[model samples]
Target: MITTFPIVALFILLGLAIPVGLVMALVGMAGLHSIGGWDMVSGIVQSTPLSTAGSYELLTLPMFLLMAEFVLISGVADDLFRAGAAWTGRVRGGLGMATALAGAGFGAICGTSTAAAATLSATTLPAMIKQGYRPDVAAGVVAISGTLSMLIPPSVALIIYGLIAEVNIGKLLVAGIVPAMIVTFTIIATIYVLVLRDPSVAPAGPAVPWAEKFRLLKVTGPVLLLFAFVTGTIYSGIATPTEASALGALAGFGLALSSGKLNLGTFRKALVRATYGTCMIMLIILGATIFGYYFALTQITQDLIIWVQGLGISPWIVMVMIVAFYLVLGCFMDQTAILILTVPVIVPLVVALGFDPIWFGVVMIVTAEVGLLTPPVGLNCFVVSRYSGIPLSEVFKGVLPHILAHLLALALIVGIPEITLWLPSHMN
Candidate 1:
């Protein structure tokens, strides 16, 4: 069954001519018939959507997406970039560093990699290039920084992983904090070193006066407030993650309106975009639900777990191998597809190895995040490349350092579980 089902599924994926959601759903249906019968497949199809979507947790998806859209449409990315540039631009290679920091900050509110890359590239890349930053560095920083999407609070990938693993979504979110900050700083430091070695690659921006530096903070102040409110509410037990998402979305809209950035066309576009994002996510969820069931019924999940335990290999090695598999898959698949296809098989393996599911959820998010910067199908690189009109090769070249930073962060989390577990521990 493994040979046949996965083979068929691979061929379907390789076709790459259909919506991934439809492919997963069809594959699941085929697997169901092979194992059970048409009756079981029929039942799962009827019930999967309601089972998957009729959850309070899912409200976070659209709400967080909407909040991000509002900020993007309202010109908040520009403000944040300006503030970051004012503070860091004076240092050699500072613009690239500032772009990474700003991308991380924007990522705090927005959870989608493609969105962060698009927004940051549009707002930051042209300015960096104009300031004499090398196209490679300018494009690379934006590509990598967009990966903050999976590390920051309200990350859509983490939310989906939580739902599938039946772990606490709020706890998983809290766990991402340290890893996210570490990655952002690591990327910044890498940029500093790269530019120092090749001085001509980055030139310094004029120093802003202290007064002007402080003045730029006003542009980003409200954004910080929104981030704090959304994440703070969840940590304090004042609301679930989904509820906080709703509040955050409304706050984002209000912020945009008060800033005079909201218009009929912009507002309409944001809604349309949010709806589209929500639909795409839901379709994947539905597909995963069906596909995951096939694995369970076929005993693939159980047999794989037993075989791994019996191998007498260090569980840590198994865990590392699993993460490595994700890295390879991420090179070709989108973040959503990676989660949907692997979480079912991988979750049981981790739990059987005595690792905390919540920690693994955080780890999975961090691992999947590299997809945004990986080659061939890296979404963030594509988004930035499209926006900056830079060649895809340059964007990929730029992302290499950031990808190393991402791997460093992933290695740290794996070697010391405390980094991911600490925040969730304090929450309880």
Candidate 2:
């Protein structure tokens, strides 16, 4: 029987003001000592960080971050948003749709929600508002849409979940392709429907000259080429994700140079930010590694799985319960923090119930994405609010409609695991 003391210790420490990584490591150290003695405790603590630091699959994390930083500093996203605006400009709610589409594209490459929200908000919201998109709709769409990155491949969340769950990261990355498309379209449709419901939310924009629309692609060419190459290589089985990320980083650097955004100062800034991002993520991994070992020592997951199995409920019921738990957890915690703390417990239960980890990763992420638009701690909302100069309440109010769309997308994936599994199943 797992004692309440360890679990209590975990919660109590988490509730305190300590950094998340430190809290996990501290509880893990205490748990390790009790279950396996000083030698085992010290041995695991000493070894986990080394193995985590040395991980080969882990190389992709930093490389992807570098790629995003390069793209950000180079203004690649500016062209993307521009093209999206031109193409969708004349349609009702089209600017918002363009923002959503550009958000998906950015998220696919960057995989960081706060950065995406801030960057895309700055890029798109001002124009959307000037174009007569309601202040709420303009900021809300960018804020919520930016979270699409958390769902799409090259995603940090999926990578972490794959690592913790011991699933194939490549397949996990690949699995997100179809579901992302589904979500992207849903987001667009949600925007369109809201505008349809109340035309004041977003007015129809004047048509772009076809010539001008195509002309905008001039600035967008390098980014389009890079995006195609990077995503294509991964989907085509031509490169491991890490290798593709390296290529993408190179492509981003080249684009940065071509765009006139490259400089010693800019390069250094991107590199430093990537380093900081990589270190923070690595710490979380190490902490989770220690915490996973601690949970194993206490048999918490194993015992919980057995007890839940004894209930004789349907597997899908348990899966829904897990999703609900994540939804609740997400409201109060950072997505990364939730991943480190819950994946160990949740993955085992999910596997024991015969669910695919990759599919569950998609579901987990979509649920978490909803949290990013929700209240009390919606980081993305705050990022958008700060950048757009909108109140947080207005931003949240705007995101509510799209949040429904996100929930619909979640239901679609949950109802059809094939949505997430089909692409991965065919991966070369």
Best by lDDT: 1
Worst 10 residues of 2 by lDDT: 1-10
Cα-lDDT of candidate 1: 0.85
Report lDDT per candidate: 0.85, 0.85
Q: List clashing residue pairs in candidate 1.
A: none
Off by over 4 Å in 2: none
TM-score of each: 0.97, 0.97
Q: Return the TM-score for candidate 2, rounded to 2 decimals.
A: 0.97
lDDT of 1 by residue, 1-428 (tens): 45486647755775676777778888888888877789999999999989888988888899999998998877787888999999999999888888888888888878888888888888889988999988988898988888887878978889889888888989988888888888888889889888878999889989899999999989877878888878888888888898899999998999889879899999999999999999998998888789888888778888899899889999999988989988898887877777877888888889989999988888888888787778878888888888889999998897787788779878998889998888888873
RMSD value for candidate 2: 1.5
**Sequence-dependent TM-score of model 1:** 0.97
Cα deviation of 61, candidate 2, in Å = 0.7
Model 1 regions lying over 4 Å from their true place: none
- Any residue pairs clashing in model 2, and if so which? none
